[model samples]
Structure formats: structure tokens, C-alpha cells
Target: MSSTFDVMVVGLGAAGSSALYHLSKTGKKVCGIDQFVPPHAQGSSHGQSRIIRQAYHEDPLYVPFIKRAYELWEEIEKESGKQLFLKTGGLMLGNSNAGVIKGAELSARTHDIPYTYLSNQEISTRFPAFKPDNDVVGVLEENAGILFPEDCIKTHLEVAALNGAEILKNVKVTTIHTHSDVVTVGTNQGKYLANKVIIATGPWISEFIPELNLPLTVERQVLYWFKTNEPSIRLDNLPIYIWEYAPGKMFYGFPDLGDGIKVAHHHAGEPTSPDTLNRNISPEEISSMKNVISTYFNLNVEFNYGTVCMYTNTPDERFIIDYHPQHKNMIIASPCSGHGFKFASVTGKLLSQLALDEKPELDISLFSISRFSK
Candidate 1:
């Protein structure tokens, strides 16, 4: 009483959905399953917008990956016949000695990526939306912009379905068991079998293979939207920006897309499981964020609302996107830490290749799970 396929993708969010979409083109019997209807608010992919930039501050190795991702996103955007990406440029703001600015510069210079180094006065002159301190400097990258998260996911799923991939929604996967030839996925409805399975489950991945004790930590992150009367805060005029206020402390914000300008502190939340995360934004949290905003920007922002998402992070913050060590038939990706949505387009293609026993065009040696052991 079950169906079978050549490949199965568990967790149809950023990575899984893309993988399913790519695999569907291989003429293989591929299928994807999700706990809830995707483009839903239950996971990490649902903020109205996510920043996509080329100046890789986290690591320069990510630059090439993002370069390929940009091309793929444009290709999909064209096929979907909808506006999925907005070219708003991007800014990295911090003092001369700040890690955020220095790292971004290092990446830009190393990769020959086009970027401009700006003084605080230059930043104020170019973008009137912010109040940069005298010593604060900036890195301006032209191609960096915003991606509509919900639209991107929906487009991938829609295109994949039209290409003959089966999508199962509202079905919770209870267990995943892999043997010699087939990987069995047991869901609330029934068991499904596949030759190989890509575990792109995002935050809830640990629930599948708890015995591995993978070093992944699920951090509860909040994205806040604020309304400002400042006319210059519109998306067309303002670029997405990351503000490194102190040595390593930072927060990022988006240009107002009519709804409001969005802001959130980077890596500044408590560790929590996906199921037990507190969903509401408290007054205390809002006040703390307001204090940060008031210190960094000149405009008065009224807090609109906050939404919660989880980051499945590794110890070093790099992603784990390789085959399961013990099980060759299983491929696993812990995620690209907190900054992976932009890479979803290219990552999906890589995952599809891995599932089909082909070499990925991009070198993913750095994201191997084995790195965690040493």
C-alpha cells in the first residue's frame, strides 16, 4: 500500500524544493514531501524578502557559490513570469576595524568582485536613509539585492510540478530508514520508498537521525518590520544593509517594500527547538531592538510585527552538504547556517546531481559533514 520512486526529497523548503525541481528534469521518478503546505510560515524561508549579496563577509568561498546562484535565480524568475528578485544593491556598514566591513572587503578584493569602499560621509551622501557615525565606513556592492522568499519557493515548486515531479503536502514524515537498495520514508499517511533520499529537513533534521548527535543547533531568529515616515526609506532609494555597530555585534535591515522596513540582529537569539519556539514577540524584545535602531539610524520607526524563523547551525557556521558517512544512499545538508536562502537556487541543482551520482559543478569540499569531527 505504498508508492516508490527513484529519488525522494524530504523537507521541501529552500534546498529540498530546489532539489526536487532539478531532479524532476532528469527523467527519474522523483518526489518531494513537506510537513505543511510550503511557502507557509512554519520554517526559515518565509520572510517577505531575503538579502542576496556578492560581497561574502561570512567567507569568500561563498562568493563563487553565490555567483552561480544569481544566474539560476534569474533563469527561474524568467520562467516563473513573476518578479522574484529586486536589484536594490547592498551595503555593509561598520567602522574601519569592524570585522563585518573588513571581512566583506577581504572577500571583494580576493575575488575581484566589484565593490566600493565608502567613508561615513560618503555613505550619508549616497544613501540618506541612515545616520552613520563619523568613524563608520561602508562597502557598497551593486549587484546585491533582495529575493522574495515565498515567491521563489512557490515558483520552484510550481515549475517542478509542471515538469512531472510529485509534491506531497500536509504530510508529516515520521521516520526515514535506509537499507541496501531503498530508503523507506514513513509518513502519517503511509510508507514511501525510493532509491536515494536527500535530507533537507532544515531545523527538524535531528529528529530523523538522533543517534548521530550532529553538532547542529537550532537558533530561534526573529525578523521585525518597522514603518517609517521618512520618504527616502523606499526600496528604490535604499539598499539592503548590514550594520556592524560594535566589534562583532551586528544587525541588518531591508529597504521598505511598502509594507515596512525590516530589521533583525544577526546571530543574536537563544537556541530553541522548532516545535517549542516561542512565537510571539515580547515588549522587552521590541524595546531592545528599538534601542539598537535608535542608536544606528536617524529615523523614528514604529514596530509593526515580528515573525519567527529557525536557523539550523553548525559549530563553525558552515553548511554540511554531503552524503551520510555510514549510509551512502542518504545525502544530508544541515543548511548554510543563517545565510542560505540566497543560495537555494544553485544548491538545489547541486543536491540533484549528488542524488544522481554526478559531480557538482561547484566545489563543495568546505561544506562536508566530516569537517565537524576534526
Candidate 2:
């Protein structure tokens, strides 16, 4: 009916699994619970591949987190003996003065990261598969690549188990109440008690902490995989790319990894709730994407298939990695605003540190909840 743990992770998707793994390393009694078995398509961490790049176009503040994330990824890959990341390089493309280009360049320069500024002709010459306009430019970072998200989550949970963390799958947490000394996590199965709790529940977080009234929205994003057999568009010649087609509008693509060429718009998605998100991909949606992406890629390919995901977006699209304002023993982590999978590994370790009352080695002051205080 009830069990106690040092730490209880309520959502074992991206950051929660990693937190469990890291916490398990400390030999503490840690447990992770997920409503659905993770690596499943029901949530944001389920896509086949996710992009990981050092030159963060969103902001340079993310560079240090990414730098540590890469190291943690390799560390886990070796521990799990599974190839989680693939090196295919990355390209941030947009007009010469667009946010995609300027932000990427600024991060690269600020962090002293290795990057190459490519003009329109240079981009076309280097990556011939792409169709860049005369004014389109790019910032190429060799360290950019792909991460097997499902495999990463699986590996994290497996390794965490091997390290002695209890993984409770198919267990839906209904409520969390802070007692005098422990947090009571009421679940469909029963109840769980923990000295500290980490709620990385992605889109479902707002349901748990309504008092915060945190400005968060759940967006329904669709990913497309178009069937393309162009020999020029092979993985060896192509790099993971995010293009700002028109000023603020942007879409991203990956090389055909057998399934097809993966493409999706960054922030253009319908606002919806996790429980009520429409998973069906309509003909109009596919046609709309096809019409726009056709000008950039050889969209002579047919729409093989598409899948849906959710993005728990903050007002500024940054991440929240701090303690709950009311409950000091509870840490809240909502890292998805379209881009979060890549940082799962490091975020896990940070959560472990916070739960254990240890100062995080890396500065997480940027993600504090106080910023939203008015």
C-alpha cells in the first residue's frame, strides 16, 4: 500500500530517468514512476532522433549545459554499452542577419566554440543536397549531431535500475502532498513517500502545481518523414539543419536514416492539453508542410508518415530547473519548449544533486523560478 524512498521522480521521461540514474549512483533509495512505459509515443521524449548542438541559437547560456550534456551522454553510452548518439555534424541556416544565424554565431564566439560561417554559395557547395537562396547563410558546427532519444531513455532507466533505483512503470501519480517531513505521492497503484520529489512531468506539470500559475502552455507539434530516394541526399553528405526560412519562421530536417527525411516546424503548432491533444495528422497539415518545404528540399518524395509530440513551453522558451517555490523539498523540471531531449542526461544529475541537498556544480541560477515573480 505504501513505500518510502529518498527521492521519488514522478515523470520518468527525459530528465526524470536521468535523475533516477544519477541518484541511484549515490546509493540512495530512489524510485521513478511513469504513467506510461517510457520511450512510448505518448510524450515528448519518444521521437526516434533528437538534435544536439553546442552553438545554441536560443542563447549562449545553454552552451555550458550542452557541453556537460555531451560528456554525460558519452559516459552513459559507455556504461550502457549502447550507441546513443550519432555524429553527423549540424548546420544553423537563415538569412545573414536572422536570429538563427546571429544567435548561433554569438554563442560560438562567446563560448569559443568551433564554427564556420558559410555564405549562400558556400553552403550550397559544401552541402549540395540543400537548396539555399542567394541570401541564405549558415553557421556550421562540426560537433552537432543526432541522439537516439528512446534508446537514451531506455538506457538511463536500465542503468538506474542496475544501480539500484526502483522503476515503476504504468503507475499514474494522481496527487502530491507535502507532509511535515515527507512528500506523499498518491498514485493509481497505491502511495509513495519520499524525502524529496522531482516532478519532470512535461506537459502534465501544470496539473500538479496549479498554485504556481506558471505561464506554461502545451503545444501540439507534428513531425513529418517524407520518402526521398535522392542519392545526393545521403546521410554522409547531409548534416542536421535548422533553417529560418523567413525571418522568424523556421523548420528543421535530418538526413534519411532509413525511415525517411525527418522535418518539422520549430514553434508552429496548435495549443492543446496533453490529455486532449489531437494525434491524427490530417491531409491539410501534410499538404501545408509539403508546399513550404518543397522549395528547400526535393519534396518530390511522398509523405511516408508523421507523428505528434507535445511541447511544454515557457513564456521565454527557456527551461525551469529549480525548486518549487512553496515546497523547498520538491524540485520542478520542465525542460521541453521544443528543444530538451539533448540535455536530459545532465539535467538528471542536477536534479539528483538538488534532492540530496548538495549544491549543483554547474550554475543553475538562470533557470530559477524567481524570474517569473512579478
Candidate 3:
């Protein structure tokens, strides 16, 4: 039997949902599947909040793409009538010369983003919860804030379904192969074919595209939500903050959004495969975090909840977004280096264009898969 769709999306998270939504708008037949429905804790999109900032601290090349992502996220909100983003201004706090702080300042200056500089004293006066050391400085970027991650993924997938896309959840894609001009995907229930394929699987990217193993390692990360005794220091009054306690050490947290004040370390994680990653937090890890967080927020932090997420990282911490070198009809997109959530909306647009053989408005040289060739 012959089976086909205009596009077959292998993962239903942010990237796949966005691509399905955009493809559906064109009245094309797009089919999407996921091992588990997203907004579920099974994948990378379950966290309650993700930071969205205009300042491109990672690299100046990211500024434009992020700007477009912000715009598209707003557009999606307007179209869907859903509250997908919350504006909690962001602060980059650390030594002025630190890569996190300096890179943000440089990006803001390069892109002309609205920002403010603050000394340790100024930060304390404005936000009593934060008590940076005397030498620490802060870069306040007005455009930075948080995105309601779960809502964004759910809304996009719902919109995609409303526009003619078919989504199958709780189904596993076991195998995929290409022949002649079509690609065949075998799932738990059945098989389907498509002219084009998009593999946006987060940590599982390597499992499906082993040829480009490209040194993608999955790291086990933990998210902690703490309840604050002072309501004034909670979500509404406090701004999102990213702090570097010392060289090469970073932690970021969001204000209490009813649940509690959510905080997590940026990169201190044990390398593990997604399937075998341990979900439980260790006492040692909690003790270490308590020490760091107590330095900033008042010690009255209440340990409320915790969850585990996976970070698919590359050597340089950049993303891998491009077509399979050997397969013209297959596209690969796994930007899960812990900072990819914010760019998911815009990335979906670009991935859709690439699958359709159309040019994206922005340059993608910086994110090309070829960067790993060396």
C-alpha cells in the first residue's frame, strides 16, 4: 500500500508543533507523532517557565533569530488568544567582565537593545531578595522575561490540529528508511511515508540519526521550586535573574508563579543517556544548591518541588540545525543545549522553510550542521 503526507514530523514538542502549525496553514498534509504528548514531563518542554531575552549573550549571531522568535511568539498569542508569555524583566548579575554578563552587554549595545547598568547596591535597593557581593554588577535588559513553556507547546500543537494537522501521541517511531524519492517511517501502530521528514527529537536525536552522532551528549538537569516566606519577593514583584557566583559557574531562577520560586543550575549535570537518566535528586546536589541560593535569596526558602529534564549538548554549546548531508529530503533540528526553548517558535518557521526548499529571512551559517565537521 502507498502511504504519504506532505511532511512527517517525528517529534511533537516545540519545534515539531511549530512546523506542523505552519505547514498546516498552507493546507498541506502534515502528520506528527510523539512517544508521549508534550506538556507532559516526558520531554524538554514541560518546565513551567523559560527565559526569553532579546540580548544574545551566547553570540551576536543569535540576536536576530531571537528577535524574530519574540515577534512570532507574540503573534501566536494574538492569534490563539492564549496567555503564553509573562513579562518578568531579566537581570544578568555577575562580574562585569564575566562571559554571561559581558556578552549580554555587548549584544545589547550591538543590537541597540534597551538595557540598564546597576551596581551591587542598586540591585539590593531595588530587589531586596538579591544581595550580590560588593564587586558584582548587573545588566538589566528590559526586553528579557519568561515564556510559559508548557502553554506555548500546548497552544501551538492545538492550533496545528485545528488547521488540518494530524497528531498521534503515545506512539513510538521505531524505524525510518528512505528509498527512491520517499521516506518510510514505521511506528508502533502502522507505517507512513512522506516526501520530506523532520527529526526534531530532543535528546533522542542521536538514536535516530546515528551517522551524525556528532558528540551529542545528554545531561541530567534538575529544576527546583522553592516557596518564599515573603510574598513581596515572589513572582509578581521580583524579576527573573541569572547569576554567576564565580568564574564558570552560573545559576538562573524564576520568581514564584503560585508553585514557588523555580531555580536550577545552568550546566553542572552528570552526563547520561535520556532513556537511562536518573530522575531523583541527590542530597549532595540539594545541599550544594541550597548554599548557592541562600547567598542571594533570604534563607527562608522553602523546598517545594523538583523535576528532572534532559539537555542535549554539543561541544561548543551551539545548536545543530541543518539537512542531513546524505539525505536531501531529511532535516535535523535538536537545539537542546538547555537554552533552546526560547528559540523554538522561530526555529520551527525556519525548519519548515528548509523542508520546503525555501529560503529563511535570516542567515543560518552560524547554526549549520557543517560547523561540526572539523
Candidate 4:
């Protein structure tokens, strides 16, 4: 195999695959390497479905990126000729004064996005699956929906390969050497050199560049699917819902998509390293999730099965999408803080532009690594 390329991307998950695809379109020799075959159950992108919403409660700065991401997803769907997104609408539920509710409302209003604030009675009347307390309300956005994560990743890889981007799967990158001009990436298989390198290896990022001491944490998240006794829990009626059950705690769920309703806590997971992560979901965890479901939703559901995934998180729960402070040729693009798969499409474009030494279309100043220096 040729050991030289214009760009080499480590980690063929969401961001890497998209980067490879966009980079390939630039007619540059680009290659993507992944430790495991993507669309697999191991990473943050593998669940059956992921929620995509415009009203980002985490921060309003994400609205523009997500807006462009929606467009990119549509383009990918048209190019791939596959069903990648499903518009089931979305609901953010919490007390009227809760941070999530207030933040989501703020983003919606600030962006001029179409949304409706519904009272608890209105929520019950419109969405029978929800049973929020009198103090709880919701912000409903019709454009919000679910994205098929595995399918999205697979489509990006397939399209990238079709565009002449090399994909090296099951290859773990051990060390990355950045010289004055080119960057050399060392993997278990062999070494490859590139003019630019993107490190999108998700949880394994710290393993390769410990010198940065990036303050990144890997959290072990559990996803549960439940079989509901009521048919109203199906997708046709139920929308993707996120509830801030407590002040700072959250649990989100999807409508029944044939198999079962998928539910999981956003960030409250066990801190672990990628190499030493425990993939098993304990019964106690299931019971805990069940307790939350029973309290918020009207559906009587039984646990079907659960899967474990990892979230590469930053301290403030924002993404880190800046180039290495010292090595400009080495771009670091992991640690999405759990809610990043939705932005993969636009992120890929941004990373590609950055690698090509071009200006990014969106303002990514909020994701710069220098913020942590202070």
C-alpha cells in the first residue's frame, strides 16, 4: 500500500467518515483508518437511532452548525438514495423554569425556528405517551427527528470509498508524529505519512496524545429498549422526547420504532477508559431507568435489551474541534460530549476545510481548545 497521502484520518466513525468523504471530494488522496469496522456496536455512532433537533438546549451556538447539518444530511440521503433520517418531530420536556426548557426556548426564539410551547395538559392531549406533572411543559419542534446512526456512518464510508478515499478498518493508530512539514501516523499495521492528519478517534484520542492532557473523560453510557403495552407509544403518535427529570439530570427516549422504545440517560454514566470499559448493562441500571420512565411516561413497558457505548466528553460538555495548538498540521476532533452525532455532516465539512487550509463555513470559535488553557 502507498504510505503517503494528502490527508489521513484516524477513526472512521461519524466525524472521520464525513471528513474522509468531503476530503475525497476535494480530489486529494485521503485515507480513513478505524480500529474497528464502523457501523459496529462499539462506538458512539452505533445505536439504531439518534435524536436530531434544532433547538439545542446545551447552547445556542450549535444552532447554525445543526442547521447546516440538516442540509448536509439531506444531501447525503439524496446522494446515497437511502432513508437516513425520520421526521418524528421532537419534544423537550421540563419545568417551565428549568434550564433545558428555558435554553431550548431561547435557541428556538433566537434562531426564529418554528416551535410551540405546550402546557402539561396540552402535552397530554397532543402526545398521549407523556404524563408530565402540572409544573412541567414542553417545547415542540416539528423539524426535529431521528437519524439512523449506523446507516449514516455506512453511507458516508460507502460514498467516500466511491469517491476514491481509502478506508483502512481494524487498524489501530498507536502514535502520531508531527514534524515541521508532514505528519506520520503509526498504527499496528504500518506507518503512513500525510500532509495533514485528523484525529477523530473518539475515546481513544487521549491514548495517542497524552501530552496535551486534554481533560477529556470517557463515560460508559447505557441504551435501553423497552416494549410498551400501549400502541400509542409507536412512532406515528409519539415523538422523540427529552425530559429534564431533575434540575440538572436528563433522560431522553424515542418512540417505538418496530422493535422497542429506545431510552437512555444523557451524561450520567460511569467514567471509564476505552480500553477498560465494561460493556455490560446491570439489572440495577435497568431498574433505575425504569423508575424514570415510570415517573414521566404513561406507557407500561418492559425492558427488552440494552447496549453500552462510550461518550468522549469535555469538562463543559462542549465539543473540541480545533487543531493542535502546537502542531497545526495535526487536527484534534474528538470529545463530542455525547450530543455530537447530529452534527457529523457539517462537522465533516468543517474539518475538511480546516485540513485543506481553507476557512470553515461556520464559526467554530466556541469549540477551540485554547478555552481550556485558562
Top of the candidates by lDDT:
2
Comparing 2 and 3 on lDDT, the stronger one: 2
lDDT tens digits, residue span 295-348, model 2: 886447788899999999998888899999878889999988988889999999
Every model's TM-score = 0.98, 0.98, 0.97, 0.98
TM-score result, candidate 4? 0.98
In candidate 4, what are the lDDT values of residues 1-374, reduced to their tens digit?
36679999999888999999889898999999998989788878887999999998888888999999999999999999999999999999999888889999999999998999999899999998888899999999999999999999999999999999999999989889999999988889988999999999888888777888999999999999989769778778899988997898899989888778899998889899877899988899999889888888787889999999999989988888889999999888974798999999999999999999999998888899999898
Error of 1 at 116 (Å): 0.8
lDDT of 2: 0.91
Task: Output the TM-score of candidate 2.
Answer: 0.98
- In the order shown, the candidates' Cα RMSDs to the true structure are 1.0, 1.0, 1.2, 1.1
In terms of lDDT, the poorest run of 10 residues in model 4 is 228-237
* Candidate 2: Cα lDDT at 254: 91
List the candidate 4 regions with Cα displacement exceeding 4 Å: 1-3
Which stretches of candidate 1 lie above 4 Å from their native place? none
